[model samples]
Target: MTRAGRPTRTVLAVDGGNSKTDVALVREDGVVLAAARGGAFLPQTAGVGAAVDVIAETVRQALAPAAGAPPYADHISAYLAGADLPIEEERLRDELIARGYGGSVVVGNDTFALLRAGARDPWGVAVVCGAGINAVGVSPGGEVARFPALGRLSGDWGGGYHLGEEALWHAARAADGRGPATALADAVLACFGTATVEEAVIGLHLGGLQIARLHALVPPLLAAASAGDPVARSLVERQAEEVALLGVVAMRRVGLLGEPCEVVLGGGVLTARDPLLMSLIERRFAECAPHARLVVADVPPIVGAVLLGLDRLGAPPEAYERVRAHFSGAAGRAAGDASGEEVLTAPAG
Candidate 1:
């Protein structure tokens, strides 16, 4: 309890991604008082202040029904997208602290959340292939390894957005006789409702269609690959290679390649569980790191944030189980709800 005779909120756990931000107010005992989801946390594009404001607004909505006041939690565990470097994490941490949102704050790249969410132990590797691609590893002794993750400029490849662009590129070339004809041309035309790949290209170039809409092409591209389209299959194969390579290299850097370790795979692309892609990824890992175990994260990344917060608070083991059970039940209910919103909360008792 606080000096005000109210229960202390132990952690304001946040998992902010490129598309959405999830916030949960968790007690030291693992009871979740309030939770909410909000818009993108794109610090790179929206500026640090604006990106944090999104989290602030979402927190306000979450805390509205709960019995709390300023300094809602003892600590803030914010694992966020766009915080790809130590400097970026520091900037965001400083901003959250300046706002007086919590008594203390810790910020890290979202890949860390993915790692904690999926891996059975605290130390392992995580590879995220979402709108962008990145990898991170943590050693038992607290050493860290990560990538610049600046997309192609940083020697990175394979993500849903990049795959979509590749689909478009191949389709356009095939239509123009510059590349071998493949079903990707038909897939692209069907995806954009265009008569030809050129029309879709023109639409993208002239702003008739949002460039982000290209993400929609990923599903069709995967479907084509599953159906054995040579060009599509090649792209999927390359993506699998990149995913496996990121995990293998991170494990090697952290001295886990020769040891038994879990390689947690998260992000939308990996979670989709496309059979062909999964098979290829498994094969690569089997050949490269036989001792490594690959696991696709079954829970949302916010669970990792909550767990990290609990870890910082030195909460008991039961606290961890309580939080995991809460989210697991919430996920089950969410599957049945038609609203499609990812909100989870438990009434104060």
Candidate 2:
């Protein structure tokens, strides 16, 4: 698709979440020139203007490494975590358009990026469980299923951030003898390198500890769960159950229950490959829908963003391969490759 001149930035793809955002610059023919990761894109917590700044800066970083990327792109597609409601998506879209990063702009829920990245069949289900939890389902008959995903108010559950908070709560209670004693208290101390939960609390209140670091505690929490910590184990189980519940509900709503369809999962929690969580999900899902095949999304969600851009271009298969090859040496590449037509992740819908 290129003539004699350098390649221009035809598509700008972004995957924005509560914790982080990724941006990539792609040519019209689907060759990725640059991909970069940046700060959080949670408009709810960070204000729309600040969140948009982060996104724009990340877009700049993406184009930074590209030798021939145009200053303006033909299209910019951003899937953001806090953009759950239609109003939110439109507002964010308008803000992005005002920045003039691209001639055309589209903003959607971050789950949609995961959906397009993981699903290749044009219809299926996707459940994302990283810092937060959300699900989306698309049916062949053109039905769509999703949730407000506005956290507790919207009946959402099972995410790394929640898991960390629960762990902290139990640990604090155990320290004060108000709850059943579990290994989590000492585990928390070891994880944070702190003397006591009291010290941690005081530090946080005194503006010493960054509350944002709370989500990072998820790994230690999972470790404690795996090491026979009852409360931790219970929390992990609940998360697995929630993941299963979301998938089952989404599929049922879209009329994909018991059908031979793909169930795609992504985010840090599911990607951890935890034995208890994985087994519980498999067992619970099999009971609900035995025929639904499950897949753990291996590639970065930004790849899903790229796929969304390519879809609009209706690029040839070879163009897809070119884009996949551009990410071949990335730190987050899948075990094999996405150079083939097959989608390595995302839901079909």
Off by over 4 Å in 1: 1-9, 65-69, 333-349
The sequence of per-residue lDDT tens digits that candidate 1 reaches over residues 41-118 is 999999999999999888988987663556778999999999998999999999999888899899999999888877
* TM-score between model 2 and native: 0.89
Q: CA lDDT of each candidate? A: 0.87, 0.78
For residues 263-292, could you state the per-residue lDDT of candidate 2 as single tens digits?
888888887877767777787777777777
In terms of lDDT, the best-performing candidate is 1
Cα-lDDT of candidate 1: 0.87
Clashes of each: 0, 9
Task: Name model 2 segments beyond 4 Å from true.
Answer: 2-9, 65-71, 332-336, 339-349
Q: Candidate 2: which pairs clash?
A: 117-345, 117-346, 118-345, 118-346, 119-346, 119-347, 119-348, 123-348, 124-349
TM-score to native of every candidate shown: 0.92, 0.89
- Clashing residue pairs, candidate 1? none
